[model samples]
Target: MARYLLKRLALMVPTLLGILLLSFAVIQFVPGGPVEQLVYQLKGRGSGGEAAGGGSSGALYQGNKGLDPERLAQIRKDYGFDQPAPQRFWLMLKRYARFDLGESYYHHQSVTSLIVSKLPVSISLGVWTFLLTYLVAVPLGVAKAVRHGSRFDAVSTLILMLGYAIPGFVLGVVLLVLFGGGSFWQLFPLRGLTSDGWAQLSMLGKVTDYLWHLVLPVTAMVAGSFATVTVLTKNSMLEEIRKQYVLTARAKGLSETRIRYRHIFRNALIPLLTGFPEAFIGAFFTGSLLIETLFSLDGLGLLSYESVIRRDYPVVLGALFLFSIIGLVTKLLSDLCYALADPRLRFEGAPA
Candidate 1:
């Protein structure tokens, strides 16, 4: 097992490098540079002033009249923007090798620090949303499978279809209208992490307030996840129910519940387990985007969106790198899960 795990871990290096290369190449080829974005922002702040540093803007001429060209050239050199693309790529690799992810031009912060600050909020949201989704989905799926084409199954199928069909942002909007703008507006807070007086409250009160603020965003996130999980669960269970082992259990006069839960459910869970890692990685990265934006939660997704709009390449690349690492690790974990769940999946010559 250790040897197999080591092999898998070793394979991940090349996969990660490929992902990094692709991401870097795409970013490098994309039009617009960090300098342009900075200039645009500065110009905007200057109230529709001419482009800074040059172009048709008279502002550049006025601003640079007293500044030395040599000093400006030194400034650009210090920032490494004077280097050719190949040199920059080499420097990026060297920095990555040393675990130095560089700095964000827009935020004037280390890439690591910016991601670290925002990650907790995204993680907190992902955890609660995933928990809610599985808590409702798994049992409901089992019940539906057991009932087959009955009313309970029919109703669940309808709800699952509707949930899957509706985009999270659309659901968020509908929820905001019903619970945040209409008659029930005061029932749930529209946005943010906590209420105004939350910090002044008792510990339990603070926890309750935080949970209250989480309701809408969590609900929006769970809707689609729950629908997908339910469909997968129901299908897996349905297949397991028809297997020969289940027939054998029934022939032995075992209780229906015992055969279903003990045998079928356990087998069904293996397939579900295979999905957990990918599902979690997806939820961690993509799920929070729409939900966070709609609810105004400041997380990695919102941060990435703002960075993209402003052409903040450092933040965009940093976030993509983080997500890529996560995806690779998640896939590795899924492979480990597969080996654990099925003896047949054990690596050739692997230790027992």
Candidate 2:
């Protein structure tokens, strides 16, 4: 197992490099990026601060027309844009060897600091969503499976299907309208991680305030992400319960309760357990995006979206690399779960 893990960890270096190279090639070669925007801003500022006339196009033209070759070259040199793409990539990798992620283009903050400052918020949101998803879905799925063909099962199936089909962004909007401050019940806070005067609150008060603000965003995330998992667990359980092992247990005079819960459910858990890592990754990365954006949660997804629009390459690439590493690590976790779920299966060097 140690050797297997070492091998997987070794493989991650190349995979991580591939991610960096791909992101670098796209962002570096792409036109109309941060450099161009900076040029336009500088150009507009060079005139009377109104970019030849007023709008963006006028500013871009004036900026381009006004800049001398020396100034252009200087600008490129200042941002390291003058270097070839390969050289820049090499420099970034070398910086990482010293544990630096460089600085954000616009913010002038270290990319590592930016991500670290925001990590707690993102992790809090992610952890809550991950816990709620598995805790609620597994039991609900089991019940639905056990009550299959009944009205409860049919109604739940329909509801879960509706949830699965609705886009998360659309669901977020609906949630905000109905539960947030809008035409309906203003039961939950509209946006943000805390209320005003949060810093002055007592410990319990602070905790309460924090949870109060989390209500809308977390609800949106859980509602958006749970349906598919629930349906999957239900289907897997139902399939397993009908298999010959279950029938054999029944024929052996085992009680129906023990046969279902002890034998059938235990085996049924294998498939779902294997998917745990994927579910966690989705909950943290993709699932959080639309929800956080809609509800104004200051999570990594929101930061990533903002950085992309602002063309903060350092932050963008930093976030990308971090997420890639997380995905690779989660895949390793899934492999571990696989061995735990089915003891017969083992890694190449795992002890018997």
TM-scores vs. true structure, each candidate = 0.88, 0.89
Clashes of each: 0, 1
lDDT tens readout by residue for model 1, 35-129: 44343444453422223223423433444454667765664575676888778877887777776788886688998899888877787787788
Over 4 Å off, model 2: 45-62, 285-287, 349-352
Instruction: For candidate 1, list the clashing residue pairs, or say none.
Output: none
Candidate 1 has its poorest 10 consecutive residues by lDDT at: 47-56
- Candidate lDDT values, in order: 0.76, 0.79
lDDT by residue (175-284, candidate 2, tens digit) is 78998877889888887788889999999999998988877777667775678678877888899988999888888999988987898788889888887897777665
